[model samples]
Target: MSNMQHELQHLPASAGLEARTVGRVGIVGASSTGIGIAIQLLDAGVPVTFYEADAAALGAGLAQIRSAWTDTHDSRLALLAGTINFHHLKDADLVVDASETEGGEALFRRLDQTTKPGAILATAAAGAGVDRLAGATRRHGEVLGLRVDRAQVWELVPGRDTSDPTLATVGALARRLHAPAAARR
Candidate 1:
């Protein structure tokens, strides 16, 4: 097998971070950050639903994802990557808020109501107030905030009630994308 395939097959599994546990995921935005997160999850055999308000933006974002793939990457991306609406998000186990901090609170509140119980809500907003966002939801215990710039260090700031399981889940996902990305503070 090629090195990339070998590496993926040999990825050291973190205890309690069961790949199956993190089921279907829904990402709020369809930009580079959102697509990057989807890639990370889809590469691990996780299903993803990309949510973009603008149909043109969704088409563009999907094109970007398709362009990034090579013959070597998993073929399942073709099936794993797709679009969905807010009503379809109730089945998602994790909902990532990849939008910039422009009216993010309202979005978070909406997600809180739409997502099923125990589903984690993650924000890709850089240095944003995750605690305040979580305050808008009753599932504050399932909220986590982290950012990835592909250029700088990041902080995995847990909200006021973010549970250990939620932190571990996001931490495992972060490690998969960039190992040793310590969740400082």
Candidate 2:
């Protein structure tokens, strides 16, 4: 067998399975940040679903995403990368909020009522009051904040309820995304 095949044979069963399983990711916004993240996730072989509140905004975001890909290539081959959407957040294993507008609060409230009980919810907002947002939506234990600046990422857990299992899952996902963890404060 080839060296590649030999290496695959020695991989753990879970590792082998994970290599074949495509992860589903949901982004609650379709703005620049959201679409950028979706592109990264797609590059990592994850399927993406985007939810946007405005139809015009969604169209704009899609155009921007396509433009970015096209700008980097001749025929815009990345257009065929993965799936994307502009409405509805349904049955997603992981959901990320990339909007810093009041929409973030509204999205969290809707997610609290609609998302699966154990689904992971994350935010890229640096200074947004994640704990307060969670408390307002009655999801204090389920929300996690991710801070990203200059390519450095940190996970922020609320001090009041930092030991929740959901936080651990979020941390694991962050690790999978190659993000570093920060202490809760």
Candidate 3:
């Protein structure tokens, strides 16, 4: 199994978040973290819009998400069924890229062009750093990085330009999802 899959398997039960605070979220890639995070949010009543370039990957992701949720809250499957290919995230309060690919940086570049003005752009960039991702966009203050490991901890790594609001927003999201985030670094 992939390293990401291992983390997903151990994902803690949800504390759920305020739907209004989260509003809408857009997630890129059908990766383990992306799918797992989506399931967590949907179960908590947050509306999520998923974007994927490939149809097959999206299908596999949706299937995995459905299986994970259907056993508990079958109704959530309907909410997770929505998937779009185009970058129509103008409404997403947070656009997170959970993909662990080397192409992750490139996706960040595209997000700048597509995401709306104040929306936060988050990536699971591991140790690659979020500078490059933050630099690609005009709203550098909102770019952040997430690091999740098999040890069952999450680290919210902020870039030089990341603003306090961005940090606070992600920190709240992490808490709501029951994923404790490490101290800002």
Report every candidate's CA lDDT.
0.70, 0.58, 0.70
lDDT of 2 by residue, 1-185 (tens): 65334423332222322221225667776656787776656555556677776777777776666675545663433423223333345666667788747556767777777676665667777576776667656657667676554453444545354334555455445446554544354
Candidate 1, residues 77-172, lDDT tens digits: the string is 654555656777778888888864354779889998898888888888876688888988888888878666564323466776777677667666
Judged by lDDT against the true structure, how good is candidate 2?
0.58
Predicted model with the maximum lDDT: 3
Give the deviation of candidate 1 from the true structure as CA RMSD. 5.5
User: Lowest-lDDT window of 10 residues in candidate 1?
Assistant: 6-15
Misplaced by over 4 Å in model 2 are 1-22, 68-87, 150-154, 179-185
Q: Give the TM-score of candidate 2.
A: 0.67
lDDT (10s digit) by residue, model 3, range 1-185: 65444433332221122222567788887888888778777876777887777888888887777787437557766565446655576678888787657555567777777777778888875566788888877888889887766543566778888776676676666656666565354
**Steric overlap count per candidate:** 0, 0, 0
Q: TM per model?
A: 0.78, 0.67, 0.79
Candidate 1 collision pairs: none
- Whose TM-score is greatest here? 3
Mark the regions of model 3 whose C-alpha exceeds 4 Å error after superposition: 1-20, 71-73, 150-152
